[model samples]
Target: METLFRICFFMAMMRFSAAEELKRNLNGVVGGNVTFPDPVLELGFLLGGRGTIALVNDRKLQIVEEIYTNKLNWNRNSGLFTITDLQKNDSGVYKVDSKKARVFYISYNLTVYDGAPTPAVETLTVSSDSCWLLCSVDKATSLLWYKDQEVQNQNSSASSLPITVHKEDRDSSYRCVAANPAENKTLHVNVRTACGFNETESGDNPKQRAYWSVIPAAIALIIGALVVWRVKRRLSEKRQTEDYAEVQINNENPQDGTFATSAESSDHFDSTVYSKLKLPEVTSAEPDLQATPT
Candidate 1:
């Protein structure tokens, strides 16, 4: 009797092992789809903690649950079942049973998660020769920073990760990744722009900044030259005016308009008039002297 009891216990353990062997695991993200393995002579499909959700009769699929009417699909040609637009609440153990000569069962453990959010990068601090960056995200299981193709830093449980880059690598490509078991999102970073040493800065591309800096100096030089030219022009004009004045003074006639030349006097003789005054002199003195003598 003890041997028979041991034999029964061994058979039960084997059965448990067989059942465990039929179980599979699956993962899906929100707004994504998952497909189950094909089944032959499928009888019914069940969800753990719930009643039957679907059945197959005469090779035709029929969904008994109204909740899965639009979300579930069964392919008759391939005998495959697919679920679309999965949600977090849809994660559970799913079972499908079939009957050929005897009953066969397969179960899938499905896990649905929210899609990982896209990572956001921020410049935390910047030194003269190095820069610190932070990568942050939500609803993600892991965050990582990559410089080129190499991993620079990573965190599995944290939502944020930090990394430092040198000035020499400012132009190198970098990416931030936020990931879950089901999906991942990546953000590309322009290292030069993110580190505040972009092409517009004099330190990064000296030619570009130099090109702009030279404009003001060039403009100033042009203005200075213009001012000098204007001053020289004014001085030249003043000198010319002085020389013209000297020439005019040296060549000006001395005679007034009232004074007539010989030609004019001859032409206007008829219209000319003259006046003169004379005084008596020696005859009066002689008469006085003679009177004295007499």
Candidate 2:
């Protein structure tokens, strides 16, 4: 009878080993579809009998036996375990025990990542050495600057991992990719910014602050040239008046109303009677100088 009982126990042990022989394979954590990856993937183990399946990561062990809330549980004689809605945080090795004569172990690694940030927008109208660049991304993990598919650098103005970006490269069509490293989640973003002013091609490019300098110089030069011209014109007019006076004082005769060769004849001539002359009336300190030529 004892031998028979031992034989029955051995048979039971063999059956249990055969049922749990399906070896577990580690899932790829980097890339591939995780069907319903929104929730972290649940990993359970086969306890064989009425035992339990559990996982240990960072010294924390989470057991699975009953369908408790968001976790998957198992019943007696169950050999399959599950993981749900997995993220990068769910990475680590999980252990399972059948409480019998078999213990299975598998290692799983999780990864997560994010895309770049979105760029701001504005209006700019300019050309030449100055080109416009743009940047825009939403919920992105990393931002890589590029020009014609060539990865550029982020400059000193920013404080992100992607270092070296230029201020002048703003109006460009920027791209961003967001991802969850643990869940292998990924997304794309496109951004744009208005082009700004560029002085690279102007024929007479001048300093912006010096624009006011030319204005004062032009005004002063114009005023000085005008004063010099007025003085010269007055001098010419005086010389011409003196020449005409000398001729009149040398010869003229108003009595015959004709030119003469002697100064005495010019002295007796009436200057006011020749030209259409009108003189101002006398004042207290001024005389009416319109008397006869003599």
User: lDDT for every model?
Assistant: 0.76, 0.41
- What TM value does model 2 have? 0.28
Candidate 2's C-alpha lDDT?
A: 0.41
Q: Estimate the Cα RMSD of every predicted model relative to the unseen true structure.
A: 10.1, 16.1
Backbone collision count in every prediction?
0, 48
Tell me the lDDT of model 2 at 213. 74
Q: Write the per-residue lDDT of candidate 1 for residues 1-294, one digit (tens) a residue.
A: 999999999998898679756888888999999988846454555455487778887888888889999998887777778889999999998876666543457789999988888888899998777889999876546888898999989888777898998888876889998888888889998878788776435655877878889999999999999999999999989665544211112223334213222222333245643322222334433344445444
Q: Highest lDDT, which number?
A: 1
Total clashes for model 1 = 0
Kindly give the stretch of ten consecutive residues in candidate 1 with the minimal lDDT sum.
Answer: 244-253
In order of appearance, the predictions have TM-scores of: 0.64, 0.28
Task: Indicate which candidate wins on TM-score.
Answer: 1
lDDT by residue (1-294, candidate 2, tens digit) is 999999999998887676555343345343222321111123333232334445433333466555423644333233344555444444444435433343333233323222223343222333444433433333434444555466564432232323222335444444422223323222222222233233342333355435557789999999999999999999989766544432232133454444432222233346633332223445467677798977
